[model samples]
Target: MRTRPTTATAAAAALTATAALLLTGCGGSDSEDSGKDKIAGADTGASASASPSLSSSDDGIERPEVSLPEGDNLIFAPETTGDAKADAVLKDNAEYLRSIDEAIGKQNPKSEAVAFYSKDSAYLGSVEWISGFVKDGVTVTGTVRYFDRKVSFSKDGSAGLVYCADESKGYTKDVKTGKVNVTEASKDSYVLYNDRLRKNDKGVWQTTKSTSDRGSEVCQP
Candidate 1:
């Protein structure tokens, strides 16, 4: 894990870099234009304010429930892919993304749902990512839209997914002061994510690894 900064601005930058490297597998220097609100986290007990939803797989595997903070929202477009296998992959993948936010919302780095939906590098990276939010005393607010999702299966049985995130409407709020750091929409607000997932014996497609590109031309409108 990388060292985190103490200052608010520096902390945000460090967190962004950490996410790109560990969680998203995008190794490089941090972008100056990246917004602090691009990531998600929450105050303690934030999850209690929202209703927890259970995500179940077709194979009768029941995933842990996940809930987000009141103001924080993640929207996924084209909820169903028409194909059964692809839909299953998308469902679990969406849950994986949601579980990360749920962990942040609960301020728990070892969130059950997060562990249930991911493993290996994805799991370790999520823990470190959530820890950054917990230490910063910041929580995400507003909405983050995920769209243009495409999925494919490999010969080895692993699944691949690519998607876009629109974070222009998202903001990071200071948990103590109730201050929201809002930013205008820009190229940096759009992000592209490429992920790999494998179905476990439990019938859950767990995210194994992922890579992201912020301000990628493909993600921009």
Candidate 2:
């Protein structure tokens, strides 16, 4: 599910979804401008389906202490559920996926990650996939660590998370062929994200339906 096509009519409309299992190919450039950059409506595909088994016991649950991102190479894996309102709705679901990587690393034309999503959030279809890499100039710089967060709540309010992602030193830079690419790591680069949250009426825990598997051996690293 690695679909890359910043244009040419989004590579001919992603070749008719080529059997549908997309997501994974963020950061794009090289636009021939048929205009359609899509990288979000959330469906990071290719799921061989095998991720429901996490329960190593966090029963005491109180985690929430991971804020690193100022370069230690990003890493977040403190999961919880001692039930402080479901751990503050999973710490606002990891700060709404770190506010969409801080609005695609500050390209911010209007991304506060849409205040934690839920307008039918697949993270708000990544706001036109981060504005087509901020309109082809480039602005997604590195680090997207997250790891092993499993969360699961339901009294019918519904909630779910299945995180793990390394993004191997994440990258994106073609501001005119300075070309960087990077996001490779392998064993399928340890990735998995299966969210579905719900709790909005101002209560917030937003995110609504998301999917991604992209090479998971239970998210290796």
Candidate 3:
């Protein structure tokens, strides 16, 4: 029953009704400009070395390994915050984002990485997002740069993270035709996200709730 952020605006129209509804928090409107930057090529296959390392919980619950396919890049700036807890939250958050892409690339609604990184509304929202891509027969490509990431802890021991995503160079690709639908960079190309995370007994920070605003003034360059 909770609402979460949607994906890029470039592909929102193509998504299913259920998916579109579930993904309202992270997308933008089409009235923006159209100037895109060149995207760099990425290596193919899922490699642990290529993705964020898994976080082990105190309960010894084995975390699922997350990986992305070719052309799907997630670049996070300031990989570390010098604070252990903050860094862990950032790393796990990156993993959660990566898991969504991984599920879409694999066309699997039941993704282990996704299940491992999220729970409750966040988890359900992610499944719907991946299902949308699968039903549309499309997958994501190109690079999504996440920067200006900041994390803070609440008195109740929950963590809140805010970050910006530059999705200008990313696009959706047709699975059957292998055609890439690229879009130009505009105000909508950048998104600002606010997420709530809680560390479980296993020592993993799972995203519980999230919200996003595309073309947010704070995220604009």
Residue-pair clash count for candidate 2? 2
Question: What's the distance in Å from true for residue 209, model 2?
Answer: 14
What is the per-residue lDDT of model 1 for residues 131-191, given as tens digits with 9 covering 90 to 100?
Answer: 8888998777788988877776666677767677898898877778878888888988887
Regions of model 2 farther than 4 Å from truth: 1-102, 116-138, 141-153, 156-158, 163-170, 174-178, 192-196, 202-217
The local distance difference test score of model 1 is: 0.67
Which lDDT tens digits does candidate 3 get at residues 92-119? 8998999888888899977777777776
lDDT of 2 at 148: 58
Q: What is the lDDT of residue 127 in candidate 3?
A: 81
Clashing pairs in 3: 5-25, 5-26, 6-25, 6-26, 35-185, 57-202
Estimate the TM-score of every prediction: 0.74, 0.29, 0.74
What would the TM-score be for candidate 2 when compared with the true structure?
0.29
lDDT of 2 by residue, 1-221 (tens): 11111112323233223212222222122122111222353322111122222222244322222232233234576556476765765666776666555555556635433443433435445566666776876654566677656565554566655566777676676555555676556665555665556665445566655556555555565
Q: Model 1: how far is 133 from its true place, Å?
A: 0.6
* 100: Cα error in model 2, Å: 2.1
